[model samples]
Target: MKIYVMVDIEGISGVYCSEQVTPASGRFAEGRKYMTEDINACVAGLRDAGVDEIIVHDCHGGSYSLNWADVSPEADGYICGTIGDSRYVDIDDCDGLILLGYHAMAGTAGAVLEHTYSSKRIQNMYINDVLVGETAVDAAIAGEHGVPVIMVSGDDKLCAEAKRFLPDVVTAQVKKGLSTQGAVLLPPEKAHRLIHDKAMEAVKKLPLIKPYVIPAPITHKIELMERCQLPNAAGKPYMNVIDGRAYSVAADSVEEARMRSGG
Candidate 1:
């Protein structure tokens, strides 16, 4: 079976502070180790399940969190740099996707480093009138192509969020957030073990997991954090920039919404 794994940094095991997630931050090196190890563990687990192809994607900021040295030789390929480029992924042929090191939506309490895409710009996002974070949005993107999000790993709140939308998704909570910037962390080894095991479970229960689909002609409403970013929110074909800080995006698929909303 083919599996796609996308990993972010804020929700990785042993991450609790913003400094760890940013490339410019002093602790960023530590964050990279955790992020890379977690993915390797997931990859190893998928291999044990008889997975033939694993495509890795660096879903975090600018895709700088991972490097060639971090990737496993078992991986079929890896996608780095800016996301939303379909050219890098064979989404059409993929069987399932795995999300690792994800956090909750902006303003989620007790969520480790919660934010939807951009913490500097987006304040809230409504999908078909339902509040959601990047996880849901990304899932909807894969779901549009008939690929179900089978496994996820993150903090306690993010795990809850994933379960809320993807009831059958296997999740491993690597940490628990005390505040947006604080969390009760888990040892890297322990977190990796959980991620590996859950990934195996997802593959085993593949038939039980369903795509977390959203209705077509979807409408997205975005609330911005900074008024200065209004110009950046310029409208798209089906998306309209409203009230400077709010944008109304109408798209047939999640990738379209992501493109229009610049998420």
Candidate 2:
């Protein structure tokens, strides 16, 4: 079995500040250590379940939070960078996708370092009139390749939000949040153990998990915090600009919207 993993740092255990998520900051290394350990446990669990191949991607800001050399030896390969459409690279060959160290959308109460794709650029986004975070957006993208998201690991709010979109997905919750920048973290060791068990269990039940899909002829909108962030073709035939800040697009699917926006 083959699995693809998309990992972000903000939702990792012990991570709840800009110093941790910001690349090249003093706390960055510590944050990466937590992320690496959590993913390693998941890889170990998948291996025990007979998984043969694992592909991991660093989905943190700028896609460079993880040190490729420190990634799990069990993984077949690691994606170190992003190119607009990089999130779903080689997705078709995988049976399942796992979201690691994820968080709730920006402004979500009791979530650690909450935000969508960009905390500074995006204010909020919607697919078919339902507000969505990165989980939903990215899941729909992975669904285009027929891969279901079977597992996820993050804080309490993130796990709850994920269940709403991926009802049957197995999740490992690592922390309880007091505020966006505050959380009662699970010890690294404990968090890792939970991840290992959850990964194995989710993969074991993979066949029953279905892809998270958005219906055809999808209508989506992205409300940007800054007007200047709006795409150049915002007012075209299938797209529109609201108040010069929010942009809406009508596409056959989420992938189509991303491709059209050059995301």
Candidate 3:
């Protein structure tokens, strides 16, 4: 079966500092390696579970953190860049989705790197009136095509949040949030073991977990940091300026919402 993997950095094992998440920062190289290791572990686990084809999307900052060449050649995958590609989790064609290194929603308590899109620009984000993070949005998109989010790995807070959103999916808590920009990390080896085990288990129980779908008439609300940027950013038709910092959009589906957000 084909499994789609979406990898983010904030929730990766041993990642507890903002310096690790940014490319300009010195620790970013190590963070990138750590992220890749987690993805590889998931791939290895899925392969062990008899999954033949896997497509991985590097969905972190600018969407180009993971080194595509470094990914295991055994399971060929694609890397999603910042230019806005259409190949993100084609749920209609995939058997399951694995959200790796996901984080909590914006403004959540005890969440590491608690921000939707940008810690500075985006104060909050809502999909179908439910406040959600990137993980939630990706899950909703996967659900639109009847693909179950079989597994998710991130911080403890994010794992708990994922359970609330995808109750039946398997989750691996690689770290615990000590602050918005810091966390208590689990060793890389331990994190990989947990991810591998959980991923394998998720595949076995994939049929038990239901796809998470946002009801029809999807609504999006983005709370921007700059009030002036709001009007210029979301000037598309059907997008209403809720206030200086908030803008709302009504769409028929997640795809429409994504387009509205310039995704």
Q: lDDT tens digits, residues 113-198, model 3?
A: 87786777788888877888877888887888888799999898998988887888899999889888777888878989999989
**Compared to the true structure, candidate 1 yields what TM-score?**
0.94
Instruction: Give the poorly placed runs of model 1, Cα more than 4 Å off.
Output: 83-88, 232-237
Give the range of the ten consecutive residues with the poorest summed lDDT in model 3.
82-91
Question: Considering lDDT, which of the candidate structures 1 and 2 is the better prediction for this target?
Answer: 1
lDDT of 2 at 15: 88
* Model 2 root mean square deviation, Cα atoms: 1.6
The worst-scoring run of ten residues by lDDT in candidate 1 lies at 230-239
Judged by whole-model lDDT over C-alpha atoms, candidate 3 comes out at: 0.83
Off by over 4 Å in 2: none
Best by lDDT: 1
TM-scores, each model vs. reference: 0.94, 0.95, 0.94
